[model samples]
Target chain A: DAGITQSPRYKITETGRQVTLMCHQTWSHSYMFWYRQDLGHGLRLIYYSAAADITDKGEVPDGYVVSRSKTENFPLTLESATRSQTSVYFCASSENRLQETQYFGPGTRLLVL
Target chain B: LAKTTQPISMDSYEGQEVNITCSHNNIATNDYITWYQQFPSQGPRFIIQGYKTKVTNEVASLFIPADRKSSTLSLPRVSLSDTAVYYCLVAPPAGYGGSQGNLIFGKGTKLSVKP
Candidate 1:
């Protein structure tokens, strides 16, 4: 079903550069989220969108931005990539905002040098 | 969201059943317990979820106590491929709080299955 897909599965960028990870879902879910996973730290939410044009900050939103111009796509932008930003980024979508199952994308591995 | 605590790591044999337990002593009434499995390079995948009692699916089973303070994810007949980090999360039902749909994840239990 191509449920959820992430682009640029791998990226190598330098510090001070900008990078955007794209996420697209075919389910047309109402909610989408961005998360980054690092070693020894489980997973932290970066940003989330309840609906198109409706976005909110998550636990670790600093230096990151998100936009949901369309329901099917939610992209995460790193304004200034840093070495700490080198982690596996994941995008997920849920049908609802409450107690719904979240389906995840393959993930984007970004390396900040 | 209730804070969850789980083992740092576990080991099991291929034919054994692995039960990973999680404790959320401060869980609220409306909170639901969910589990997710993540491989080395993939995103976490939802495994099973339950509010109370027991919920069974094709892949796994979730057992919750009456108080909802703890949960256990039981996997049957483990294999090498089942080696992954299993996360346990507790969050209130949507719209009840500010971080609705925001799943707060803690360091999960790393399961290692050997032949």
Candidate 2:
């Protein structure tokens, strides 16, 4: 499909397990971002990639890892998932800078038991 | 990055105009104010953006005063579907290689539109 999409719309896993959420965009934008939204709160950026192979940490990045091996994909990995890591993860893409409007994916809901 | 503060929630009836204001006292000269609206179980969608004066788009209007210390997002004749969380953010001048904390999203104002 066109635009941005996320895999495993819903997931369930045990603590200390490894989990990966995939995000893909057809626009081939230069900027890709990962944000986690907890209940009753706004989105907090976890990681952002300026381009392929260039990623940086955002507001909450301690337990999450992100890589952009290709321009179309930016995957977030939870090496050792914890109960606090359970949240709705959203992937966003923008053509240019921070002032530009971002296009967001449907989001992946992961639960760590 | 500038810190933004807004109300936690608001209530309005259908066909009434609703405005949600955000304050950013420490906003920089190169920053721009933007707003986003998110429905339940979905990602946020951009509503409008402005630097000064007023900016109007099909979805909403953004009003920024001369001081640029605050901004208001105005929605016209809001309906039940417009009941959602509205986020106000101050975007910094730089991108890419700039400081990663240029954008901060606090708990946004949840506007509930009743019938």
Clashing pairs in 2: none
**For model 1, what is the error of residue B39's alpha carbon versus the real structure, in angstroms, after optimal superposition?**
1.8
- Please tell me what DockQ candidate 1 reaches: 0.56
* For model 1 chain A, the run of ten residues with the poorest summed lDDT: A94-103
* Fnat by candidate, in order: 0.58, 0.67
Q: In angstroms, how far off is B26's CA in candidate 1? A: 2.8
In CAPRI terms, where does candidate 1 land? medium
Runs off by more than 4 Å, candidate 1:
B100-102
lDDT of 1 by residue, A5-104 (tens): 9999999999999999999999989988898988787888888888999887777898998898999999999999999999999999989864678899
Predicted structure with the largest TM-score when compared to the true one: 2
Residue A1 lDDT, candidate 1, scale 0-100: 68
The per-residue C-alpha lDDT of model 1 at residue B101 equals 31
A-chain TM-score per prediction?
A: 0.97, 0.97
lDDT of 2 at B1: 67
Please give the lDDT score at residue A7 for candidate 2: 94
Docking class of 2: medium
